[model samples]
Target: MKPGSLSHGSSTAWGKALRRPAALQPHLPHVRTPPTPRRAHCPPIRCGQVPKTPFEGFVARPPNSELHLGNAWSLAHACELSYLTQDEVRSIAEGRWGLKGLLCYGYGDNDGPDTQCFAAAGPDFIVVAFRGTTSITDWVRDLKVWKLPDGPLGCEAHAGFLEGVQGKWKGRSIIDSVLQGVRDLERQYGKEEGLAIYVTGHSLGGALATLAAAYMLEDPELRDKVAGHYTFGSPRVAGPRFKKRFEALAPAGRALAHRFQNREDVVSKVPAWWRAYDHVGRWWYLAGDDQVLMRNPDLWTRLRDIIDIDWDFQPDFVYDHQLRAEGTGGYIDGIEKNIVRSA
Candidate 1:
């Protein structure tokens, strides 16, 4: 087995289930509201309750060894995007793909007060990576919820993350730049050439990546080109409506989307999935370095994760949400360590 990765019994049931296609139905019309926030003093972790959203049957595949090389590559790119400089990004990513062209853009103000994404592109694929929150303002952004325009393709998302993508840096929309980068690749490579498009990020970047990919897939042409969607320690992004629409838009089999959650990586469980916010892809959970196994949540298992805040953050939700912890299972350490092992 790969370093730090353990194998379970020879069962590959989870991987097999992922490959099996699921039927899609036309969306049902209904107004959905966000779940009421729970008091923090109470144990946020749902003890034993089944979630309204489908949670059973989805499985977390084993670590590095079981993941597709492409998935690993995508994760590596996402890590580089997490904090590395543009030159550093190019240095690490260019040698792997035999890529010729490189383009990079910084969308938000990075002056230690704002959250932003440093998106980059290569000849065959495009990557949009977001930086985690670094300020009191950013944490506040994470806690506040505004009704996202609801419709056939609408659901509530974290207002701050949405703003980061929708707003502009120097008057340019960050999300637009991401879309344009993929389009440029497609334009150069052409459809018949089978250009592979991918989107990835960590923490806030992961959430933004999901939003950008969902929006891009809205176009029929772009949907066909998406090769992978990978995220690490991503908080839940949108409500069930957006998820259903995204499901219909991307579909299974056609889109190879995977969401990775490490042990106790608090961000992955936030903005509760039980609430209107739901995740769109299969989850690859890493249960430390022990044997890897795949199984769905039991009937009594709760889908929504209550983010238990630190005692000191009694009144400040922002600082409570902005706690910093990183290591083997953390956003940066997990990816970087795995990349080193694979290399």
Candidate 2:
């Protein structure tokens, strides 16, 4: 399958599967039910990091309100956005899908630049999604969070992430692109009908999305228009100072800012608590029913369930990062089951 193809069993599959679920699965329920078992004759699943088979049943545990199904779908959408190419983005724009593509901006001018993201508008919401680092060099960028750049935004952020978000793409600032996407949506959809703006991504993309949402919230008008900021497998993006700033800017209920942590995902724990970096806003934990080993975590608690660094070095680290297979576990599986039932 190509970069943007809707290959079965990947994020793209979820994107196509969910395109019109509004018509089919009117409400993505948060119930638990077993998935269909695979036939004995089927080949042994090839994917080892995460289970390829969907989980038997799913029961969501949102820290605050009932699991926000809309937030779950947005996460799936944001994940899919990371897979799209410029051409495929155009195809989605011209198609009948509920999501209309707007921008696919990236400064791939050099070998490995830490700047790339996209934006889009639906009837009632606008989405700004950042693509996680795709190259080894980009991964190097992920590690360089040592210095705080001088700026009016005194709150210190993950140094690399701050630079990535502030960098220019195609002669225009990436932040400006996101803001412009929202403004264009407002022009087309009108800000009045309770239109929402969602900033989301997975992994590094999630970090950038968090930064974008924080900046948006600083503007009183934008804060009211935003419905939620959702991220999957996102790392710590700021220190306590910025955390306090984010809380004051958006608060918990003002606009939902949720970090969906997959069970044992080692990435979410990085820029570690020991390093004094803190996760902002609410944490909605997603793990298998059997893996319900963790209760809600406190600010200083090192994620109790994360695969420990001292443990055996292996693929389990990578497996924990995968979006739970269709029914295996995590937020997407719940939405997948609901879609199947609706169909």
Candidate 3:
């Protein structure tokens, strides 16, 4: 056959193939639900060490939020780049954060930090913070005080959050925990030059992740220390002013590593658009903020239920992933590397 003739035939074939039936088309791999006999736990979560999956050098524990593949991938990347190294990073456990709620991402818990699952190393962090939350510290000797769920990624809350919350829907325990975690990191790896203070979380935990970053940015000293953040399915926390406010105080490049997901994802849609705190002015000062369409995250995945029962459920994590990969997470990490690479 002539070269031009062959080319023409290929083009024609491509066009014809485009008309194939929808069922006959190929689709991207999808995450299937756990089999009928799911993890016996109420809201199943998996926590464990990802030692072989490209994260050999780091130690990790799944925060019981949701041990998602994407979150795990991002966690490995962050640790490798020195953006967020696993250490004696500490976190407080919530009353099994995700399993009992529908809006698991909502900030609605607090109580004298009931337990300290010090990761001398363990899965005490929000294995999920909802994706297998882990720590970088081992100061404590035993896990006796730990209240880990059945899965490896179980997490009630991390150490840095605000105290005396729960009822107020104002969570800062996660905040304080992070601050302390940073101090711990400084104590342990301070001599390790080029070290960065980074925070990451997926879904409900993403909200906490942002909250933690915000607190760190509030302090010039702390902000300068942190390198960046990587979040997946993070909801819209605060408003436009948050970016500016954090930048002014921290000076350090702020990055929100964000990734969105389609199914069983309620985090991105949390802090519902209708919340008064959606704006910067409110979020920074308001006491108790509520929103329309908000549901109890204690029972199930709100967004997923909505999609599965109320609307067409063809959701995509691509947009959420793009928002972070190309925007904040990637851009800020680049800047940090340029500046802190040799520091």
Q: TM-score each candidate.
A: 0.62, 0.70, 0.38
Find the 10 residues in a row with the least total lDDT in model 3. Answer: 282-291
For residue 338, model 1's alpha carbon misses the true position, in angstroms, by 10
Clashes of 3: 77
Winner on TM-score between 2 and 3 is 2
Please identify model 1 stretches exceeding 4 Å from their true place: 1-70, 95-97, 107-124, 134-137, 150-152, 189-191, 251-255, 291-343
lDDT of 3 at 288: 9
* Cα lDDT listed for each candidate: 0.49, 0.56, 0.31
lDDT score for residue 272 of model 2: 81
lDDT for each residue of candidate 3 in 67-122, tens digit (9 for 90 to 100): 22333443523322221112212211112111111112222223433212111111
Model 3 regions more than 4 Å off = 1-51, 57-174, 192-194, 247-264, 276-343
Question: Which run of 10 residues does model 1 get worst, by summed lDDT?
Answer: 17-26
TM-score of 1: 0.62
Better of 2 and 3 by lDDT: 2
Q: Candidate 2, after superposition: displacement of residue 10 in Å?
A: 21
TM-score, cand. 3 vs. native = 0.38
